[model samples]
Target: MASKQASVASFVESAPPGELSNVVADIKALAGNDASLLQSLEPAFRKYNEEQYATVKLPGSSEAVIVSEHNSMGDNRYFDTASQTSFQVEHSSQTASAVQQHPLESSNADLIRSLQKSFSKAAAEHFPSSVVGIYPTSSDSDIAILLVANKYSPQNFWNGRWRSTYTLSPSSGGLKGAIKVDVHYYEDGNVRMSTSKDVDVSNASGADAVVREIAKAENKFQEELNRAFVQLSEGSFKGLRRQLPVTRQRVEWEKIGGYRLGQDIGGGRSK
Candidate 1:
């Protein structure tokens, strides 16, 4: 059974021991500001990425001066690869050896789908002047990430137990700006970054409205434009969580099954 799971799982080579220090540093940074976004599940999430043996850090959501979104300069088309899709119930496992692999599990798949739905709905709920997206969904091992591309796209991670927040590499569309993002693993851990900007040039659904709003609200609060980003930021996100305090509440299956729970081809984190 372990062999079968390994055959189906996606695997990546671990970074040399030399890179371990950097990875640990990044995860700690993420834990500092984005703990609430993770909290209960970071431990399990780290376990799933056993190959990496580190919590994947999410990058900052945006650069300073989040200008009015010009018409989406990104492409609108995307393809779903069976191997590339996230949250398969089959994808969870603890790697006995760093080389061990596993398939996508159902719980993980659901998490991806949920986050994707969140991004789609944001277009309307956060409409007119808001931009949203999801990307860099890693389908390796039992670990996966579907980042919500808002002013600050919070990267959502799934082991079996699902958690979301920002992280450095194994990340998709990163936050824009000079602000750096990092995190520490409650379990399996990793850290990454890029010198280039993680521009979301693929999703074009809400481009028109986002563009219009950016044009309309050009010189307003840099804070206002990145409300979702700021709201989901390390400090502000705490306040937002206080209002919702995501406790054990039953979600009407039908609600999530219907339009109330929608997923865009672009990206929505679900599970």
Candidate 2:
């Protein structure tokens, strides 16, 4: 029989790339059966929070100071203040409470409008422009969340369950020079919420121009995601009794000849 260490080593070898080192460390600790070894891993778990904070910067000022560092379950929120603007960065797992919320049973025009107003207010206050477009990647649930957050009714909410991409452009009577935000859902149950803006500030020279652009984009992305999460949690969407069960299925069509489809099978618990 192979030793426990040997077995763990084999498992680590076959594990997915980027996960091997962590897997090896975990297995080694388990094999040792020592509580202290497990405790030591806590620092590794916290490394992400530190690294995320290191990338944070305040716009328009080099003298920005850290205002607060709030730590929650597997996540951290850092607030930094400068002369012109205050900035915050939330580093959290995809499964963070802000990202995962209960789905809404139904939606209405008034509710949608209210959400849009809130989103616009936050965007206008934090960025150069409001969110002019929302691109959904992989999940319509995100769009549903967006519609519920923005107070805009999704056109085909009742038109059978399917995913669609929405573009709110200036040509379509939306806000001109509006920031573009993308909401992406990952298989690891993580959400990648981000935003971008076009910058053409006049009279700004050298690195200051580049720094200002980056600061604007980062602040916009952070504020949008944070505000959307808050909206989703505020009794607007119905909460699930427990986490939704997720399953993946592969379907092959012999009649269609050489066609294969993959589907994620899950839904909110029936009321």
Candidate 3:
């Protein structure tokens, strides 16, 4: 019986080291793969959470920007995050007068639809992975447009919360022949930055020309918005970080953790 016990212990000691080591390595590899998979899936999960709760608190109801969350769910979920930030840009009466015979003055809905189509096209061209939506105000006094850039990736590791909101209205008096633009930008639900500019498109000839001018202004604002995001992400606005609300801080913390883990694991695998 003692010999039998001794034989069993010897067999166990003689087992291959590579077999046990390989098993341990495989377990670690699986853990790493799980972390990677979760990292890859995080964007979609965040988008789902955002859509489920991030309803834009508009002053009134408008269907133009109320996109179906389910329909927009997928790889580019950042494009679906709803924006609460908004501001207005007013077009002068003189510009309207110049186009009095134009379709915009005749039907406000038509004007909103036209601008939506033009702006949506331009946004797509400028931001390849962006989602654009335009909604006319219930009172017809203004139109709100949202642009969301879907640039989040586990590999590249960005928060992917960049968005811009533009509100367009009809200007009064001296502002005629120009579009007074109030642009608001949000990152992770915080209004971290904004800019206001008067775009002089008085020289624009026709309706199409006017649309082109607006698109140009939108593109310019978008460029500034992108720059502001870069500045904030690079820790240039450390002072502003202290002012962030608790909700925003939580969002930012999660994003930072996710990206840092992704970078560490990615670097480890490469070595």
Candidate 4:
């Protein structure tokens, strides 16, 4: 059992982020439901979850800029405050390795080009004036698409992002994908909404088909978010807002008019 635990620890230290879950499942099977070994690996899992998604550490800061809970997408998206640049960490389903690269220069040039064209068309048709970016994963078989838009003025700001990741199957060439939507809007206070959706692109024949399918799914997801926002505004947020303070008192007219109202009731006052 100790040997098993040691071996599992060693493998985790060297395993790719994508395979970590599989490793745990394998250990659970081997241990025959022995919870001790799995419990021992908790720290490792926590560390991996906390550290793997963090890309940039600010100068003079001892910790990562972002720490997020583990999710199957295994994506890292963060904005650097100092440089004011957004960074993404992409993972390839083929290699299970993570890499940071611009999508245009990827080895899968043809695929990236096709995806970019599709993305542009969709963005222009639906979300004008939005910022969009495409990133290449570790291998040549996957791509991550990011769409961001924000409206800000003197009083309020609204920010939203839709991130989609697509991986092509080696045998069938079909695409498997997921989309994550995040919304943060500030008016008199802060309001946030986040949602994840699974995109069914397995039947999609080509890159254009995949993008269309994703768009359809995204529309539905957006509707869900809209409903959620309305509920939050009417329910949770409404209850939390401040209306009036407990200390209540009448207005003092003597200080405002420089004389007591009782002393000068009529239009004719002391000249």
How do the residues 1-271 of candidate 4 rate in per-residue lDDT, one tens digit apiece? 6787777877654443234556666777887867787778755554553333322343444423332231222344433222333444321111112223322454655665676678767866776444344445555455555444333332345655455555654336566666665566667787666667776556665568767876787788779878987998989988895554332434455675774444444335555
Superposition error at 28 for model 1 (Å): 49
Candidate lDDT scores, in order, read 0.29, 0.33, 0.40, 0.52
In the range 183-227, model 2's lDDT, one tens digit per residue, is: 434354544444444433333222233234434644665677678
Could you estimate the TM-score for every candidate?
A: 0.19, 0.22, 0.34, 0.44
Using lDDT, give the best candidate's number.
Answer: 4
Q: Is candidate 1 or candidate 2 better by TM-score?
A: 2
lDDT value, candidate 1, whole model: 0.29
Off by over 4 Å in 2: 1-25, 30-205, 235-237, 241-271
**lDDT of model 1, residue 113:** 46
- RMSD of candidate 2 to the truth, in angstroms, is 20.7
Clashes (backbone N, CA, C under 3 Å), per candidate, total 64, 8, 0, 0
Q: Residue 181 in model 3: shift from native, Å?
A: 17
Instruction: Please tell me which predicted candidate would have the highest TM-score against the true structure.
Output: 4
lDDT of 4: 0.52
Clashing residue pairs for model 4: none
Q: Residue 261 of model 4: what lDDT?
A: 47
| Number of the candidate with higher TM-score, 1 or 4 | 4
Model 3 regions more than 4 Å off: 1-107, 171-211, 218-271
